[model samples]
Target: MRHILSGIALAAGLLLGAGAPAVAQNPFEPVVYVNDAAVTRYEVQQRMRFMQVLGAAGTDAAGAEQALIDDRLRDFAARQAGIEVTDEGLQTGLEEFASRAGLGAAEFTAVLERAGIEQQAFRDFVASGVAWRAVVRQRIVPGISVSDAEIQQELTRRIETPVVTRVLLSELIIPAPPGQEDAAMARAREVAGSGPTEAQFAEAARRLSASGSAAAGGRLAWIDLENLPPSLRPVILSLSPGQTSQPLTVPGAVVLFHLRDTQGTLRPGAREQVLDYMTLRLASAAEAAALAARARSCDTLYAEAGGAAAAIQRQTVSQNAIPGLIATQLASLDDDEAAVVNYGGSADLVMLCSRQPALLAEAEAGVATTALADDGVEAAVPDEGALPSRDAVREEIFNRKATAAADAYLAELRADAVIRRP
Candidate 1:
């Protein structure tokens, strides 16, 4: 996977049509074949260009060729399975993909065109992905399941062993335009050696970093150390608070990271604690206070909410996952405790029903399941407003198993087919 900083730079470079020169070959000629499907040089060109536009790393000819091959295999399998992406479904997928970059489908296509990518190529690429996911769901999901015993076993294992490390980091990326490495390196060294305050570093980042985080003073959210790239991990681990790293070079960019702080999570690999709570919005502060006074328990509040002009909602979320202000307000409350806050011209009476360590299996499933669920393969779009953090655990686990099954199935298909390259 491309590093986040590199991905950002690549995206910018793609928008500006900056990258290694394109392969100077006949785009219409067939370059490879999967089963009976021909992968034209033109398709590879489009895929490479599109990948570049997406700030993907290693968008070289070989990489593009291999990616096109995998895509061809996936498409062929989807076709054999009778899975097809309707034009409407493809358009929705395009829109959702574009939304990630904060662009509408048309706007994103225009950007691609400006960068010399064809709109049809983008559509074909997305269609393959959508169809392949549907194929996975149909063929593999039925056979996979996560048992309650497995969840309990995972929970027990987590309780017996824990691993925890997290870092607060701010980043700076100086674009190393071709032939400007020395100048960029000199600037990086000067900044790194200056022993600058966090403010000074952030100011430098604002002026020089090419990353999206530059808009936010290059500050990043707290990240688990294990998520850092292997090469970058040691450098980050070595830094003290307020210290910046020596300039490091990545493809097309020179980078420095400021260490804001580092600390362990509450427990090493602890099951994330989830809170089940309800909030009732009332018309007036007096009414809210009256309800709060009358309700000593969450159930009582629920009962009081039935007769009042109240919009009640229940949500389950981990502490850190909650909005900062609300999390802070709820931090001190014990089970069955109530708190009132004013929101949007109304009083919100919140009651805490329960807090417990989420099952380790559920937490793992949430992360794994997100890949399949967010892909919109087997279901309608979920309600984003009411999505619970741990609700998808089982689905995620199922997806993971299904993904493995799908890969095996693909491998069997590949082995049985004759592939050709020219």
Candidate 2:
């Protein structure tokens, strides 16, 4: 979940030879192989030092190794997708990273060098992040969707009624086994492009789906709205009862949904309010409390967040799109209200800047949409363009879901990869 702007990306960049006795091994010797690619011992130590530099919480030797392993997976997936980071893009990433620490790129590089970190180590780390982003935004985000129903559902939940809402959906899950990924995607796309009718889709599911429901014509039991994946909630809501979804990529396969029916007494609620909230993670609980006292609004936190821009995040999203934990924190908060939540030794000061109704937030969010960065978990900048509030909401939801799908995609890549430790 660490962004490039992370005070520390990966984890404990343990100082090079901080205390360990000198060993007679080569730093550059290959230690792990991700398919044909090699991971060197030097890279692992460098990553550990990178973690130390960023002051990452709870970082250990094992966490550092796993982080590097994941980096290889991310890099491997990006390459397979034909994604690359240009020199200019890499430089921009470095500049943005340094600016977070209130320094220029060159300055940050000098600081790392002084700490005995190699320049290429930093570059490779940043490049991995930049390239992975391209892989997600270009390869995955386009296929994401957010239902008007999801948005309206959140707004409807405000109705204070006792009515329950549920969906009846049929599934067509196509397995995308290793060495057959492209063929599977092509087939799924073919099915989607043709827009199969309910009967035809059911038959295809029975023939093609790898899910257990295949025997039952790909039919699934009724599922509560809250029970669905956060990404799929809007997707399900957007469909009319009888519609089929574009193929959705899960960890191991592509899935198509046919919403069979809905049985809920629906009623309109209040105007949709897209929330504007900012969260800052400080080093400790005491620092979080200090931030809570000092920053009364999201705008004020920018000054308080110091050079760690990635440590602070701001988002304008549908209430339902927010993660369960953060959403729970924001639930009872008022405008400009702040709360301190602890995670181990680390802590976050979450503040609600404004909860404007859709109409009211249109001007701010529509004029410029937030752009994602740093593993696509943080929104660090805004893009210039004109979009309606609803569309902006949709974009935010798509980014959230796309990032999640990107993770699933990465996992699939790992599963299919030939990883080995030498």
Candidate 3:
């Protein structure tokens, strides 16, 4: 089931009239309206207040602007699909938020106030949050699917990737008494050339080596190749298994490494999986709309094959199959609004599908088995555990770039709108 979770409200500054009182709110003067609902000044302020309280660092003006836009988009999507966030949903959200923050709901509010967040304004923020998430899942998630090959490729890449392990040793050098520079060099050369055993090195460091690591026998932990300083990296990389590096000098001291072991260098390949099933064929657009209309209470609408019941069907299909949209927007559905998604047009709608991966060695454990029996011999389904192919990543990149396009498109929408500033 799509969980309708609460999100932070989008904030935008209001255009104030010269003679208007500071508290006056103008609903007609649009700050931003996603699909059509007014995003108010109070909503924006509460979001800002929360940002300040949470010490969130990335709230630049452009980010804030886009957040407001996304807020509207989500709310618009929800409304278009006839999704609504109820009072009980909001209360549950409040409790969830409090629990996440390690506070009681009442205590969380008090904390917000202490952080200078006003109560009612925070409420609007919560409401908008709930509403926007409703929109995202209803409108966007159905079209998203991951493919089996992509999952296999990702698994292969992850499993086959190699890691190089080396034992790194660092030392803090204490310059030998000035006149003893040549003697120090002699000792340094001896240590470098002798290849003393670790215990021998520790003893030599204690008696003759002028380094702080004398106490620890100059031992450093195993180091990943990536974290090595650039100057010593070439030396480290040149060494093979059971090899030690020549002494490398830094500004004041020297660093050394001993190549120990290497692991992983696995090539890419496919993985096996098993999954359960529920597929809802809302026969028509009318049926899709009808399902949306019947949705009411969280469990009630989802109980039998009602408007929101598809999610329950999905859950029954497989406990592991969650709504694929993992971002804040899709998670807020509260089950009811999430279950009845309005997929317009004549295409057969499938809802409440879930999967569980089966052991590869076991018979009949393959991705193709999870494919819709009616979808023909070759239909693609995503393996959630795998990396997407290049096309998929490219598509994701394109979708992310959509907001700018959406903004440009909306500008035309605004030009056509006969909006008046109040």
Point to the candidate with the largest lDDT.
1
lDDT minimum window of 10 residues, candidate 3: 1-10
Supply the TM-score for candidate 2.
0.43
Candidate 2 regions exceeding 4 Å error are 1-21, 155-392
Across 1-422, the per-residue lDDT of candidate 2 in tens digits comes to: 12233332211222322544376889789888888789887887777666545544213456667777778888987888888889999999999877877779898887777656789988998998998888888778778878976654443333333233689888888886644543454566566666777788789888998989988888888888778876677778778877887666555566788988886642332345678898887788888888788876777777876686567888889787887777888888998889888887898888998775553344444543354576866564442122335565666667779879988988898899898888
Query: What is the C-alpha local distance difference test score of candidate 2?
Result: 0.71
| List of clashing residue pairs for candidate 1 | 369-396
- Which of the numbered candidates is closest to the native, going by highest TM-score? 1
Worst 10 residues of 2 by lDDT: 8-17
How would you encode candidate 1's per-residue C-alpha lDDT over 1-422 as one tens digit per residue?
23333433444455554443567777688988888789898787777667655645325567788877777888888888888899898999999877777778898787777767889988887888898888888887777889965555544444544333789999999987865654565577668768889999999999999999998899999998879986788788768788888667687777989999887533433556678887777887677778878888877776766666256787888777877656766777898888887675777777788775654435445643332456667445442222233335456666678878988987887787779977
Q: Which stretches of candidate 3 lie over 4 Å from their true place?
A: 1-37, 40-42, 57-62, 162-422
Candidates arranged by TM-score, highest first: 1, 2, 3
Of 1 and 3, the candidate ranking higher by TM-score? 1
Give lDDT per model, in order: 0.73, 0.71, 0.46
Model 3 residue 105 lDDT?
Answer: 73
Tens digits of per-residue lDDT, candidate 3, 1-422, equal: 00001111111111110122266655234566555556555456555446433423213333454555555554454565688889898877777666765666787777666544667655555666776555534544454565655544444444344434343554424343423332343355456456665555556556654556667755556666557665556666666655545544333333344454443332222232223323345656676556545644334444545563443433332223434432122233333343333445442223322222232212123343233547465447553234334466546654554544444544554455443322
